[model samples]
Target chain A: MTAPLLEARGLRVTRIGDAGPLKVLDGADFTLERGEVVDVLGPSGSGKTTLLRALAWMLPDAEGELWLDGSAAAEIGARVWRTRVALAPQRTALFPGTVADNLLAPWRLKVRHDAAGPDSGALRRALDSVGLDDVALDRDAAKLSVGQAARVALVRVGLTRPDVLLLDEPDASLDGDSAAQVASAVARFAETGAVVRVRHQRPDGTATRRERLVAGRIHGVGDCE
Target chain B: MSEAAGVVTIEWPQLLLAAGFMVVVGVISLRLALGLERDLALATARTYVQLFVLGLVLRWMFGIDSPWLVLAILVLMVAAAARTIVRRAPDAPKGMLGSSFVSMALTGFIVTFAVTGLVVQVEPWYRAQYVVPIAGMVLGNSMNGIALALERTFADLDARADELLALVALGASPWEAAAPSVRTALTAALIPTINSMAAAGVVFIPGMMTGQILAGADPMKASAYQIVVMLMVSAATALGSVLAVLLTYHRRFSASGVFIERGLRDDIATARAEE
Candidate 1:
């Protein structure tokens, strides 16, 4: 059998505060296989976002053994590992430029030197897949509405073609219709053998697996569809 | 008057006139409710005592013709300057003080030595008069640059944590992720030096030029010295600011290229604890 695309064992995250250190994630274990969509449901402040960030290797202090493509996380160079396992954060973080500029940003990174950016046609198709029109490429990214910016971020990450995508509330700002469009886009991406993990308020009806996070631990693990 | 001889002499009576002017300013400040009288008095006292001690020390330095003494004094100045810089960025990571000291010392020594030994070619290379004053100017200005750069870099990183992490998630190395903030900090640190250089001739006569002229040097020669001093200062500021940012930027990230938010939080916490 093929190895899981991403795996984490005994993952723990701590956040130091003025009051003292807070244990945000407690020995959370997870695994993602190709073409699987895992939905993590949690209430506010339940360390859902923290779990996503820790899996992306963006957390400052985390204790766990993580493997990507069967290689130890520590052995994989950070840039190389992140290029294959991308995280779209909760807040829409776009540069001060046109949407096209933001879309082209990941290509400018040194780790992407071996890979060329999508052509104009491919860019337009990626935008359309996320319910965005081609006109968004030229529009100022800063002027985009929160929902539009979130879609742009999703599309941008999709353009990178990462093997594992960790999305934190990718539809938090969207309306029902727009949220469905984003879910469909994610579903299409997952069809191409990419593993996806999303932190969401409720199931979007696309997840194959569902887990609820409560007080820094995963409480339930079951099949969704 | 001989060119080497001092042209202006200030006797006790003349000095008293300057003190009277300060008192007048203090009285006006009181009338305006500026609440500067106490601070003014304290500053005036500090200026008097510090300059008086400095004058005696300079006299002794002039009498001693040892290069080691000059080196020792410069080292001491760099140490004090590094301490001041570190104090400015209380939120910086641990070992920032040591890193800043090395940066300031390296930049300070390079620029001061270049000016005194190479440009001015002062006999004995480390003449107390030339090396002392030049090193003072270099260390003092470079200290300000390093402090401003460090403070700005840390604050910017903290404020833009999300943006920085987003860049990292996009496959950026820690250095690449911090490029914008580092550029901003370096620019902020160098603006003062750049502005001073631009305004030196038109806005005002700088202290070094005025001092040279009052000491009976030719005005054109004094201007030349001032120009060189300004250039050296700008170079030192640029070097120090860049070094400071480069040295401290890596501390913001982990070996796995993750931005260490906890490290920064811990640093700020430690600073607060100390305070």
Candidate 2:
């Protein structure tokens, strides 16, 4: 049997409070199989985003056991693990350069040295997947509108082609049409047996499995269809 | 006793006249209700007592011909400077005191020795008169530079954590993610030294040059010494600030190329505690 793409057991996160340690995610357990879209629904101040970040290994203080692609996350090096599991944060932060530079920024990393730069055709396709035209690639990424920046961020992360994508409120800044485009783009990206976990206020009907988070714990899970 | 060849002594009456001028300034502050009268009085008293004690200490240090004693004093100065920097820059990270101490000690000793031993050719190479003052100048300036660099780099990284994490998510190394903030901090830390270098002769006379002139040194020779001192100071400040920032920047991120949010939060907590 093939192992799940990502699995977490007894994960917990805490922040230092004036009184004591404040628990953010308490014993949050989850599993994601290939070709699955998991939507974690919660209102504001819930632990939806924190859970996603913990799964991405972005929270150093997080405590739990995480397995990625049948290997213990602790056994896998962080740089390699991150390449397989990427987190596209809620707020889109663009570098101080053109969209082409922002999109190609990942290729400049040492880990991607063996991989060649994405061709123009691939770049155009990635942008087109997110409702952005080829012309958007040359514009200044920093000057893009909030919605445009969010889409650019999505495209940028999508081009990395990770096995699992953890998106935190990807549609929070997007309009209805753009949100639809993002949903479809995510679906296309996940069609290759990759797992996509999204944190949203409400399920967008694209998720195969829906989980509700309340006060730092998962309450229930059900099929979205 | 008559004034020595290179010594200019201030008589008691002259010192009293200076004290009277300070009293006049205090009175003026009080009359104007600037709310500085108490601070002015306390500061004047502290300055008087500290300088008097420093004079005695310097005299004792100069009387001793041992290089070990001079080294001991220099170590003490570096430790004091490091503590001052840590206190001044409350936003500095956890290990900042150690980093600042090492940076200041290394840069301060190198530059001071270069000036006293090579440039000025002081007789014993560790003469308290020359080495002590030069080392003090280098340590003091480099301390400020290191503090500024550490504080600015940490604060900037914390503020732009999202930008940094984005790079990390793209498989960039921790160094690559933090390069922008480090560059900004280094530039900021060196600006004061650069400005001082630019305005050295044109803007105003520096304290060291003025002291040499008042102590009966030739004006041209004093100006030359001042130039060398300024160069050493500029070099030390740059080196110290860069070293401190590089050492402290890595602590802002974990080994996994993730920004240590707790590190930034701890820095804020430390700043509040200091306040």
User: Which one is best on TM-score?
Assistant: 1
- lDDT of each residue in B97-192, candidate 1, tens digit only: 888989999999999989988888889898898999999999999999999999999888877787877889999998888888898899999999
DockQ score for model 2, please?
0.54
lDDT of each: 0.84, 0.83
Model 2 agreement with the true structure over A42-150: per-residue lDDT tens digits: 7766778789878888776677889988999979878877878998988799998998898888888888889887887898888887777744678987789899888
**TM-score of each model, paired residue for residue:** 0.94, 0.92
Give the CA lDDT, 0 to 100, for residue B240 in model 2: 92
For candidate 2, what is the TM-score? 0.92
lDDT of 1 by residue, A50-139 (tens): 888888887656678889889988899778888888999887889778989989999988999888899878888888877787455789
- On the 0 to 100 scale, the lDDT of residue B49 in model 2 is 95
Evaluating just chain A, the predictions reach TM-scores of 0.93, 0.93
What is the lDDT for A113 in model 2? Answer: 85
Q: Give lDDT tens digits, candidate 2, residues B85-190.
A: 8887776567778888888888999999999999999998889999999998988889888888888888888888789878887777889888899999899999
Q: Supply the TM-score for candidate 1.
A: 0.94
Model 2: how far residue A51 lies from native, Å? 0.9
